[model samples]
Target: EPEVTQTPSHQVTQMGQEVILRCVPISNHLYFYWYRQILGQKVEFLVSFYNNEISEKSEIFDDQFSVERPDGSNFTLKIRSTKLEDSAMYFCANRLRLATDTQYFGPGTRLTVL
Candidate 1:
């Protein structure tokens, strides 16, 4: 069995700095997504990407945020400028195929903005 992977399990950064979170989804999954959970808060959807374009996005994915699939196996999320409020655990998820909606989630990349 295969699973999603995220790099730099933990990250610490100063406010106004940029951060890029990386993810690798399951080998055959077609739908990819990014979600975030602030400490003590509920998990929130950030954006969804398919076929190299965005399929859906939440308000949280504003001008400061961007996502890209730089290669066939890797997906990335970039935050242009970090804020204290941006501190949270970011997760990556992917669905096996278009026939099903089931998504497998990655452990997560924790971002701490000071």
Candidate 2:
């Protein structure tokens, strides 16, 4: 089966710096979402995108964070200013609008903010 892929499997960045994480899709999907899991914490929803715009976003997705689909293929999440709490494994998930409503996730990009 096809899947989503994230780049820079591991990333280390200093606090107050900017970082851009990318997600690429290898198969067809209707809805895309971004999620993060802090150290030892539950997977949290960050944002969801559809029709090339943000459909919904959680409180954690503040001004410091932004999402976009540049080049009409890959999705990207930009953190304008990183903080220590920003460190987590960022995952890219998508849904095929099937009957079961299952979500497929990427391997994830680990972001470590100092």
Candidate 3:
């Protein structure tokens, strides 16, 4: 299993500011990547990146966020309009091979919106 590393391990911004968080996954694991945000006691799915397929998003995929894979191994999650409530530990994670496999997570990026 390969590990995913998220850069800038932590970020802070004023409410309404824009922030971009990055994820770097191993090449072979490029089949896809998904993101979820963990805040307090809840884990909510955010988005999924498919190499050549239509991306999937959750209800929380509201207008304030955007995602892009700048290259083969890196994925970026952008918060176009950060709110105080958007502050949380955002994780880039997904199951590698099968459903039975435990989901792997990147070093979560802590986003703090002031």
lDDT of each: 0.94, 0.91, 0.76
Query: Residue 82: error of model 2 in Å?
Result: 0.3
Clashing pairs in 2: none
Question: lDDT tens string, model 3, 1-114?
Answer: 568889889898999889999888765664455555656566777877676453688888888888877765687888998988888888887556554756678888998889
> Residues 9-104, candidate 2, lDDT per residue (tens digit)?
999999999999999965668788999999899999999998799999999999999999898889899999999999999999988767477888
- After superposition of all CA atoms, the RMSD between model 2 and the true structure is 1.3
Clashes of 2: 0
Q: Cα deviation in Å at residue 15, candidate 3?
A: 1.0
Candidate 3 residue 91 Cα shift, in angstroms, is 0.0
Each candidate: how many clashes?
0, 0, 0
- Per-prediction RMSD in angstroms? 0.9, 1.3, 2.2
Worst 10 residues of 3 by lDDT: 27-36
Q: In model 3, which regions exceed 4 Å deviation?
A: 52-54, 95-102
Off by over 4 Å in 2: 98-100
Listed in order, each prediction's TM-score against the native is 0.96, 0.94, 0.84
Candidate 1, superposed: residue stretches over 4 Å from native: none
Error of 1 at 35 (Å): 0.2
